[model samples]
Target: MNSLLKVENLQMHYFTSKGAVRAIDDLSFELMRGETIGLVGESGCGKTSLGTSILRMPTPPGRYVSGKILVDGVDVIPLPEKEVRRNIRWQKISMVFQGAMNCLTPVYTIGRQMMETLNEHSDLSRSDAESLIAEYLGLVGLSPEIVQRYPHELSGGMKQRAVIATALFLKPEIIILDEPTTALDVIVQAQIINLLKKLKQQFSLSFIFITHDLALEAEISDRICVMYAGKIVELGSNAQIYGTQSPKHPYTERLLAATPRLFKKVEQLQFIPGTPPDLIAPPKGCRFSPRCNKAFDRCFQEEPPLIEIEPGHMSACWLHHRG
Candidate 1:
């Protein structure tokens, strides 16, 4: 499969009064065309930062210090701002942000918002833009008439659908879905997940689905990347990630244990011992070593590089690499 998006040695750092915070460190991954890749991690694990950096969105006090982001083989890291705006953004890559419900304009009707998106990126007149809006809304299983309603009048699920519809309006090749169902109820989340599955097939789109929900990611992703602190601790296929076998990384195992499964009954779920280390002044060795029960002397003295354990399974723990 050809890679539609390739991120290599990506790093994002934040300058603060305390010190330099390493938000994302040496993260690398590839998303094949028409594949769904899930980025799973706990809060403050740089999942959202990774997504935003790919799109080159505003990151105040933060900068992309190093690395390469190649979309369709074009290195986006050092591309001129004008070229990125004119050639890369929106037309090729788009984002369905985390809080998409609040992204809608309260004053404007859904139709107007959709039309604005179409007009800005596409060469469509007022009437043609309105027609395109109807087509996109229909694509996302929403009625064309709903376009006339304002954001305040629509339900939470409806607002999210509208936001997704707007994202698909440009027919982007790669879409970053950053916790699209985070604010919705269970029923609504299911609906949104189903809708995403449907759209993925219809559009043949490659996605970077960022979320803390492990079960949900297992359901939709082709591959999973487990991140901890500011680095990728594990990367594997969905089966490798969710199979009966325990994950190699202790952090990954704890995350899987914490998730609530449908059939299994977990009386007392195991919790990770300590909080994630501060990026401003991160500990010397492995960032997860302090909380990890499997930590040893080497774990405290040296950071482990991500190494391939099996054919496609990669882990960055000394235990896995040494054994």
Candidate 2:
């Protein structure tokens, strides 16, 4: 059976005045039906780029150079932009973008923005569309009356709920949630995470949850993909990733070390020393080699392929690849 989403050796880059920046280089992954995959990485590691690439809607500076983004056995890259917008985008996949609370245009009321999506995607009558929008608002614990109000009128949590409600209104198969809970209070964050879990089960949705919080990711993600520099350095189940016995990838090991374990108290928290590599002129070998503690001759001279260390665990590191 075909995966819900399959991306093979996808390469996306930005053409800057200085040079080309490989925002996403040779990235590949799969998301099965109803599976939530957490994409965890430090900032500027192309997490957002990967999200935008799914809709084939990268911003002006960046472009999808090559690869296949197959959704349920259909390749989306070859489709015309207008066709994709009319059919695939939103109707099949939607994004609750980072700062989605601010996604609503200041000029349009919540109802109007929601109506815009419903009108453009489906042929539902005006009255029917408004009813559907109201129903979704109510489902997200928001009053139907709030649709007439503007974005500024609602509180932060309310705006986020409204945004999510809008994304779900069309009932897409896949949702890319990029930092969905950033800038929210702890209580509000937990509420949103719980809501997401409930919605996924209700809709049988596949989710690509991109965030830096591995702990939070572990709570919701069935599989976790750890990114470094412009590539996926490690991919595994939550248990394999958080395993105590296995050494794991050096990058993943440091990430786990840095994560705050509320129950397992540590003497002192750790940090990944040094900085991420420059994508514009990245090193020839492993992108994380400059910062890896286990770097050796092979690490400096040759890039490691992402190899499956076990049935479902894959890591891109010379140490794991060495025979």
Candidate 3:
């Protein structure tokens, strides 16, 4: 499979009066063409930050500290801001932000906003851009006539579809969907998920699906990347992450235990105790050692590297590294 995106030792931090917040610390992953990699973690675990870093659009005070973001074999981290916006952002990769309801401007019609994106990125004529917008809107299961309506006139599901349609208008190879099904009814969420699968098959596109819901991730992802405290703790196939095989990372185990299972009878849903560590000054050795029940002296004294515990499965934990 062709490699579409490669993130290597990518460190993105936010500078403040107090100290630097290590939002993404030495994170590395490869995204193959026409593949879906699900990023699952609790909030503030750097799922969204990783997405923004790939697009080189980290919010103010948030800046790239080190490492490379290679999209299609070309490193984008060192590119100029203007060059990144013109050649990389939206052209190669685009993002569907967390809240679809809040993504659109109430004053602007859907067509107008989408048209602006086309105008900024490409040299498509007005008629051509409008036609493309309509085509994409229909592609996402929204009616062409819906493009004329304002955001305030659309339902939550409609708005979400519209946002997705806009992301497709750029003809990007990869899309980072940050909680795409969020804040919608169960039926609507299913509809959106179906639409995404259809689109992925029809276009041969790759996706980075970011969400806190593990079940939803299992439905769409070919592989799963589990993140904690601004780093990946485990990465493996969906079956390896959710199947009978025990997870290599303690965090991964606790996360699966916390999620309710439909097929299996549940006496109680277990939860991970304590909050995530502070990014500004996280623990010295293993960031999860403080909360991990299986922690030992080695876990608190030395950070573990992400190493393959089994074929095509990697985990960063002392448990996997112990002699």
Best by TM-score: 3
Summarize candidate 2's per-residue lDDT along 62-167 as a digit string, tens digits.
Answer: 9888999998888898999898978789988999999989767889899998899888788999999989999999888899999899999988888999989988
Backbone clash numbers for all candidates listed: 0, 0, 0
Residue 112's lDDT within candidate 2 is 93
- Using lDDT, give the best candidate's number: 3
Alpha-carbon runs more than 4 Å astray in model 1: none
All candidates' TM-scores?
0.97, 0.96, 0.98
Which has the higher TM-score value, candidate number 2 or candidate number 3? 3
RMSD of 2: 1.5
- lDDT for each residue of candidate 1 in 1-323, tens digit (9 for 90 to 100): 89989999998998878887899988999989999999999999999899889998637788898999998888898888888877777878899988978978788888888888777777888888888888888888889999889999988998999998888877788899999999999999999999999999999988899999998898799999999987999999998888876677888998988887779888897778779999988888999999999999999999999999988999999997664
lDDT scores in order: 0.88, 0.89, 0.92
Query: Which model is ahead, 2 or 3, in terms of lDDT?
Result: 3
Worst 10 residues of 2 by lDDT: 239-248
TM-score of 2: 0.96
Candidate 3 stretches greater than 4 Å from native: none
Better of 1 and 3 by TM-score: 3
